[model samples]
Target chain A: MRISDKYRYLGIKLTPQRLAILSYLDGNRSHPSAEDIYRSVRKEFPTMSVSTVYNTLDVLKEKGDVQELTIDPRKKRYGPVNTPHNHLMCNKCRHIVDINKEFKFTLPSSMTEGFELTGNHVEFFGFCSNCRKKQ
Target chain B: MRISDKYRYLGIKLTPQRLAILSYLDGNRSHPSAEDIYRSVRKEFPTMSVSTVYNTLDVLKEKGDVQELTIDPRKKRYGPVNTPHNHLMCNKCRHIVDINKEFKFTLPSSMTEGFELTGNHVEFFGFCSNCRKKQ
Candidate 1:
């Protein structure tokens, strides 16, 4: 779906900044952080504030339109995909890619500590091809 | 192993502050962040700095004595467990627990995107019993 149509389908407000953000994220696989998104969009919207980017991301995350990844220790990365899957990140370049496959593993009921498992995310870390060549 | 003996095993300098931090983290399952550690340590030291906590954590992380968790979006949390395992977090209270079991998963070669898989961590998020009771 197009960016505008996606927000419309989700009943999100169609602001110009949001439109620009959605356009940037529509098929973005980099799993960009809020700063990355802000920097990317600011090229076109120079007056865009980082707080606005964070707020928009918060709304999108609350709406389940995007997945916020804690794969990187330095910052949170956002992905537009909603499918249940794991993430693979390059330890060298910090490049992130979606695994797009279900890695099902049952946490023994004994270890659950009386908590129900709603969902799980796996982050696999290694050197990407480019980073490997650099080393 | 005791905190002092653990640092001795890793050949880390045993400063009074590091000892204080390590003693605090010994068998700690709360997964406190750098700020959390700083705040906790400051109660006794009164003048302990956040940077000292972070530097100590960095050394501990490098020595493979602690694991840094990105489960919290606001900050990075640390665990003293060195075992290979996953983490479970309470989505409501932000409480984190170590899932001390092997959750072995294999990624098909097709999904690797030319990256070698070094390690993977699973973060399971849900409400804790206390939070559930509150609802």
Candidate 2:
């Protein structure tokens, strides 16, 4: 079977397990963790170990096919590279949501200290309605 | 001598070591790590330990006098709460700089999933001119 175009650029051997992981990450905005992905993919590959999922993720991360997020502070989450975006998080519950729109910003050269510009990620912190009611 | 007004709101005992730390962090935009603080504070109080710096940082962080940053991935950095600001980083060298200006953004209510907005931090990634030259 041919590898899905989602992971075509990785240029690595596409094991059945790696293909499953890549399929899971395609268009995934929930930013699930390694364990989260393993738990879901394990349904199909019952014998698959979490390490397999981690190794696949590590390879994808190194290959720039995936982006890692630690917006939750205590846990790692993964999102698809299909769109460059930022994140919004609930300070109380630590729930994270994606913000697909890019903000236009430029730092004065004096402030950047001669760094050539590339890209930016904005993390917005807030209280979810449920958490806000708890206060 | 009286403690500087910078730490007056923390309301903790003004030990000489804690004072030195607060003084070190006061108006400090370098986003130094615990070891960085320890290294600099050691110059004056050779008896001071790294843990002392860590504990003091914990208290200040708990009290909201400092904000922790993990931009470097391998290490943690810190900045004072004196002013709300964002950061610009060198993707090549991982050098970080402060951008004191705030970027205004509004997420559609539908996008937030009912989060009450509070604050945002933008992390700009780039290659410092020196690193670009080296490449």
Candidate 2 per-residue lDDT, tens place, A24-125, comes to 998887778888999999999999998998788866654445666646555667766544558877654557788878777677777878877766778886
Error of 1 at A51 (Å): 2.4
TM-scores of the models, in the order given: 0.66, 0.64
Question: For model 2 chain A, where is the 10-residue window of minimal lDDT?
Answer: A1-10
Which pairs clash (backbone N, Cα, C closer than 3 Å) in model 1?
none
For model 1, the stretches where C-alpha displacement exceeds 4 angstroms are A1-12, A43-47, A83-102, A105-119, A124-135, B1-11, B43-47, B83-102, B106-120, B125-135
Q: What is the lDDT of every predicted structure here?
A: 0.73, 0.71
TM-score of decoy 1 = 0.66
Question: What would the per-residue lDDT of candidate 2 be over residues B19-103, giving only the tens digit for each residue?
Answer: 7887888888777888999999999999999888878876655444556664655566776754455877664455767787877
lDDT of 1 by residue, A1-135 (tens): 865676777677779887688778877877788999999999999999999998887665544455677777777888764445478877555687877887666777787787755667887766687766633
RMSD of 2: 6.0
List, for all models, the DockQ compared with the true complex: 0.40, 0.40
lDDT of 2 at B38: 93
